[model samples]
Target: MIDWLNSTALTAFGVATTWAEVLGFGTGLLNVGLLVRQHILNWPLGILNVLLLMVVFGAAGLYADMGLQVVYVILGCYGWWAWLHGGADRASLAVRATTGAEWLALAAAGVLLTGGLWLFLDRLTGSTVPLADALTTALSLLATYGQTRKLLENWWLRIAADVIYIPLYGYKGLWLTAILYVAFLTLCVLGLRAWRRAVLA
Candidate 1:
């Protein structure tokens, strides 16, 4: 059990990794931990996780996700600033829920962005799973944007993305990342509950 769990996969590309995966996974866990706690540390840990996962995804031929990491860096910065100063008198941000209209708009945007990215990847890149890649990437962008706005529904979006991410990364031979997403999915649920109570409070 220990060996199977620890073993690295995908040696053909010379990208077989266990420790890097562990480090990245650990950092991601911490990032979400801080997020659940509504602490300020989530941003920096998120940056570190993005950097690490960029290498992981790049090696796995998920170029869209690699690019997504770059976007994550930018969003992380924005989220950091918003969390610090987006409230009254530069206070910490408060949690909020998305309106029905905003939800509809976000759904429309998610679909359009997915289609656009799928076309882009299919035509311009050597992506093996462009549709799945595009869909997850687009959803992740929306979720990240939701987090920056301090929306409680962001965790739902993340959970949605992870549903695809788990199988995608596993198929790509990033077993560790696949495992991490399982952890992430669980955390997303917990985060949703935590933020719900936070909003009520």
Candidate 2:
């Protein structure tokens, strides 16, 4: 199983990648499905997705994104706990919109983190597409946090990241991952709609 998961198998758009990516892509889609339904199981599936993709991104030299998986693990744990108990009397968190101040804070964090990581990846790491890598990483962090907090806007952030990721990963030769983003983009739209209705409920 380990060998098979770690094995490189497919070639598309002139780039050869691994079975791990294929598995990661499949699980990622599952993760999105669960999130769209507001199911807490998304956290565990997302954790698994991140672990697999970490290897794939590391192999592709997207060091920032490779590191993002670690963040996802931490966020996944937090989201799982929060979804269970981050509410009055240990109730589940409800979907909601972010306030203006909250939006400012999130936007600031994304911008600053993107700039810092871009510089570090450009100057220190062997990363080739530092700008796009850092942007996606930053946006992903915010989006994951938004999901943890049950914010309706998380899906928008993810959708934005997905648009950039499609071409970015494609250019980096992660064809399967790019395709996964396409699927994610579609799911993000649906998640946004579902979560919006959830907010109304």
TM-score of each: 0.90, 0.96
Candidate of highest lDDT: 2
> For model 1, how does the per-residue alpha-carbon lDDT over 1-201 read when each residue is reduced to its tens digit?
334433564343345765446677889888988888888889989998998787767766889999999999999999999999998898878999999998999999998999999999999999999999999999999999999989999999999999999999888877767888998899899999999999998
Residue 80 lDDT in candidate 2:
97
Off by over 4 Å in 1: 1-15
Candidate 1 Cα deviation (angstroms), residue 190: 0.5
lDDT of 2 by residue, 1-201 (tens): 656766778776776768889889999999999999999899999999999998888778999999999999999999999999997799999999989999999989998999999999999998889999999999999999999999999999999999999999878878889999999999999999999998887
Which ranges of candidate 2 are over 4 A from the true structure?
1-4
Instruction: For candidate 1, give the lDDT of residue 178.
Output: 83
Against the unseen true structure, what C-alpha lDDT does each candidate score?
Answer: 0.88, 0.92
